[model samples]
Target chain A: MLTVVKNQILVCILSVKYNIMREMLNKVTFLMNVTFMILNNASILIQWFVLFRLREDIGGYTMREVMLLWGLTAASFGLSRVLFARVYSLPELIVSGKLDSYLVQPKNVLLSVMTSSTNISAIGDLLYGLILLAVCGLGVRGFLLSLLFVVTGMIILTAFALFLGSLAFWFVRVEMLSGEMVMGLISFATYPDGIFQGISRFLLYFIMPVGMIVYHPVHILVRFDAGMFFTVLGYACLLSVAATVVFYRGLRRYASSSLMEARM
Target chain B: MRRQEKNAGANVGVLGKREKYIGRRYGLPGRKYGVIYRSVLMENLQYAANIALGFFGYFVFIFIFIKLWDYIYQTPGELIAGYSKEQMIWYVMMTEMMWFGSNAGSVGRQVKTDIRGGNIAYLMNKPYHYTLYILTKYTGEWSVRLPMYALLAVMIGTMMVGPVPGFKIVAVPVMAACIILGLTINAVFKICISLLSFWIEDASPFQWLYDKLLLVVGTIFPVEIFPQALQPFFKLTPIYTVCYGPAKLIVDFRPDKCVEILAAQVLYLAAGCGLMFFVYRKGVKKLYVNGG
Candidate 1:
């Protein structure tokens, strides 16, 4: 059993390496992708900058807290996109039956599918997030804590996306619907959590859980609490397991597309 | 003898057999544009779910802004940046509606697809002008989407803040004109950017940059909210024509201001058309020279 797990781990690593090598083959295109992504991330930050310039606080969040919010969101989003980009395209994969190769492979299908490719542009997002953190001037402890948030946030976001994409198993032409829901999720994530109230706030915390992804992390970083940290960690773990179960359950329904396909 | 007669008769037609056929149906100066426009409008209606979901996403933002502005107002009749709270929310709704109505992504993407997919080669040989063809098609799609979006915005706006005060019934026609012009300006700008793919191979980054600018300069908040130093620059850019100008006119209509805004829209429209032609002309040359 240990050897089986070891072999799966090795296969996942090699798959990631192969994807990286293929992307690096076009160094200029890869660089361009990263640069533009950085620019795009910065451009979004400008909206907050404009907002903060006008007023000192929004939903009781000062500029510094807002900046932290963006930093966490960008880092988490970037990490997921860079390392497990397939989560975004899972609907297309499922609907088109591109999962056949993963099913045939000896490795764990979910991990294999998740690590099959990387988005070079997301590297820009990751770098930009680090830059924002530095700009915010985090101490060693704070920076380490932010790193913890980045990993947990990525896990939650990837799991959330997996859950959403898994719905393709039962539905037809759900690609757009899933895409819009993800956009709606990101839309809420970028804003200061203080702005949302009542049902909207409740929806963010539960249904979308965008608050868990960025808002709660920003709050925890600003003023750390053991209970909140543990809750976040527990939620991430629970969500991850739920996502895996849902995906495999849906896997039973996937029919093949009969197209010549590759993992990358 | 039969082949010679066929070849000789084909020359009498304006361009080709297909051209003669399509031209007769859409040949008239006024009717040609209408036919292409209606076809695109119908095509957009076929993707009902996609359009519905898109509006739902837009609705989320509108919901947020209504809350944000409500919190900010604090008083019954407070004004921020020359707009009352109600006007401010209405302005956001109008802007969001116009933003969605642009439908410029598909316009630019179609251009890129045509160029990259090598469809441009055959499309260029068609009887109609490629630029006008794309513009009419997109205008139809925009027209189909706009009324539904506008109606939704009005319904939501009324529900959130009641009817807009000082909203003159007469201003609706003027607002509609501005909105149509905004859609045209947006489509033209995208077509210009997409034409760059004939040289750059990937124009998406430019589109992304342009979209970000539009988001910051006008869509997120009005240009009036920006620092005074940057207001003129924002107004001069195509962003004003696409979203800011139209929405502003709807919220705060003045006959004098209308004249100025309309003139600017006209100027931008002309400039956009000019840029579209210039880029397309150069791109076609590049295509021909490179055998694309």
Candidate 2:
């Protein structure tokens, strides 16, 4: 029994190393990639700083207040890239038949493939995003409430990212399709979720869950609404399970092909 | 390393005397510059329809955001965050136009494909700075698209009920400086992304990453809307400086702050250009001439 346990650990280590290798080979951008990240991020920052400093209380938001709202939008976008950045990888995997190699691997292949290597630049985007959240968080009436919302919002975001990535199993050409959906979600996450009327709010809350990622959690923090905490927790748990089931189910449909077949 | 080629190197130094001319390999102008520029322009122009469609497609998004923002603010009939209905509406339109103006990303893929195919060495053999030549090519491309976007903006101007100009004063010199800085930053980004071709076997993932990030940081909504805690870091990031600075300057000019922003813009351009050189130098040094 002891030897068997040791063997299992060895297999796990090997699988981890293989995943790392696959990631390193793919994500390493010699020099150009670094420059691209620097330039683009700089432009984004500049736009944020300028032209957005005004305070008018039209909808119960000051200049900085709106900034805080906008900040959440940035956070959702940044987090999406950081965690589920691999969702963008699905189309190429399908077209190239690289998914075949994952099927033959020992570990939970879907997770391994999904997170071969986190986007290093996305770490910057994530940091930038959290900083935005913190800025908004500073205004919260209760510190503990803000932290709770952050945690719950993160849970919902993770589940959503997984659900999107799993869609690639059915749609081989899911790049633009997934991209558009995520962008639309970012659009939704930017605003205060409560502004939507009865049906619109319901659509966002249940149908999409994007509202829960940023606006709903934000609303909870500002007002210290107790109900949201439980509701968010329930949704996070349910969706996390759903994401796993969808990805594994998608895996069964992945048919291995060759470079020659792929080219054809 | 071949004996016959080594002995013949001295003779081929003379351009017309050699079977394949080597004159273009140095700073000297290749007679083919005009022809090369023309062909590149021609090839780019073939995709004009796609460019028009892309501009229109992105424009639709502005209206959607406008509707959404309007709905969010329906009950309260005052400015949310100092943005009047008209100013905020134009804000959406301007941001979209700003994006259309500053995109040099598509050309980045050309460099990556060339690198992957091992065809970049062919350009290295030409008599021009690769960076300058590529920038020139993209400048021509943008020149074409900028007008298309301007035309669309005019249509939006006439059709939309949003930010109409209170008056028209040409912020010419500032605008010029912004354009140059914007283009330089964009060109550098393309070069940076293209350089990844040296390390990554395929460039598709890198391209997608760049595009998505661009949508968020480079052009989308202004970063001021970000939470206060997040503002400083977003401001410091280089992308916000490049793509955001120019359009914001036009939409809302602060002459006192303009110099400082321009200075920052210049710094980013310099940094982006310098980074490209460093990358290209190292990348070429490590380059294995994979036979095409």
Candidate 3:
């Protein structure tokens, strides 16, 4: 069993490396794309920059805290996209019966699908997050804690997307719902959590769970709480398991569309 | 399945020959492009589920902005950056809806695909103005989608924050004109970016850059809120015309501001059209020179 797990990890790593290498073949273009995305994301920070310049605090968050919010969100989102890029395309895969390829392979299908590709621009997001964290005066300990939380956040986010994308098996054309959920997650994750109130707050924490993906992690990173940390860790683990179970269960309902196309 | 087969057959040159032959026979440019527009509009309308989902996504963003601004206001009548919270929220709603309503065609993505897939060669042989063909398709899609977006905006705006203050019955025609101008500016920007695919392997980066500029410069905040030093620079940007100008007028209608906005829109429209034509014509020449 341990050997099997190790083999899967090896395959995942190799696949990611291969994908990165393929993208980086044209070093100049890859660098340009990455630089453009970093600048694009940094420009978004200007909105908060102007907002903070106008007001002292927003919902109890200082500019520094807002930076942390954006930092964690960007880092986690980047990590998820880089490691589990298929999470974004799962709806298309399921609906189009592209899952047949993974099913035929003698490996963990979910992990195989998750690690199939890496987003070239997401590397920029990862670097930008670290830059923001550094600008916020994060020390080594803070950096380490952030890495841990970012990984946890990535897992939960990917799992959440999988759960949503799995709905495509049971229902036709839920791709929009999956897409909207992902967009909502990305949109809400960057904002200061305290601003959300009542039903919005509830949805943030539960239905959409942008809170679990970014807010909780940032909160724990800023001021470590044993209970909260454990809760987040547990939530990530449980959600990952639940997502996997739901996907496999739904696989039975995935009627092949016979629209298969060859991939390089 | 039959439609898919027909589409596949069309791609394999059967339908292309027929369409090309028809285009060559009929020198009626307007009718041919009109058919393209109707086809694209009908194609978009057929996907009701997709349209609803898109509206829902737009709603989610506006809903969040409303909540965020509601929290920011803190006081009932406080103004920041020369806008009361109500005006600010309304401004965001209008700008965000302008994005939804505009015919911002994914020309960049389409061009990138065409170049990467070597389909541009075939497209160049077609007997229509490629840029005009795309613009018409975009306009048709925008026309179909705009009503749905406007209805949702009004419904959501009325529910969340009530109607825009000082709105007049006459404001409708003026706003409609502004919306058309705004969409034209957006379409021109997209076409220019798409044209970049002739030179760059991935024009997507350029599109992302343009979108970010629009978001930060105009969509997220009104140009009035920009720093004094940057206000002129922001005004010089097409973003002011595309998103900020019309949205501001909707929230606070003034005859003078309306006139100024319309004049700027026309100027930007002309400039945008000129730039688009230059880029596209040059890009096509380059493509041909490179044996594309």
For model 3, how does the per-residue alpha-carbon lDDT over B110-218 read when each residue is reduced to its tens digit? Answer: 6677766777788777877777777887888777778888888989989989877677768879988997898878888888887887887777888888999999889
Chain B alone vs. reference chain B, TM-score for every model: 0.88, 0.78, 0.86
Is model 1 an incorrect, acceptable, medium or high docking prediction? medium
TM-score of model 3's chain A:
0.96
User: Model 3 - which docking category?
Assistant: medium
**A1-264 per-residue lDDT for model 2 (tens digits):** 888667656654564455445445645452334445444544454443433333234235444445455555554445545544555566567656677666655665655565553454554444555565566546555444545555556556656766776677687545455555556666666554434566766777777777666666656655656687677778878888998898788777776665432211
Candidate 1: share of reference interface contacts reproduced: 0.45
Chain A TM-score vs. truth, each candidate: 0.95, 0.70, 0.96
- Choose 1 or 2, whichever is better by TM-score: 1
Error of 1 at B247 (Å): 0.1
Residue-level lDDT of model 2, residues B40-64, one tens digit each, is: 6788688676566465345546655
Off by over 4 Å in 1: A262-264, B1-23, B29-33, B288-292
Report the Cα lDDT for residue A178, model 1.
Answer: 79
Tell me the deviation in Å of residue A259 in model 2: 3.4
Quote each prediction's TM-score: 0.91, 0.58, 0.93
Report lDDT (Cα) of residue B268, candidate 1. Answer: 93
Best model per TM-score: 3
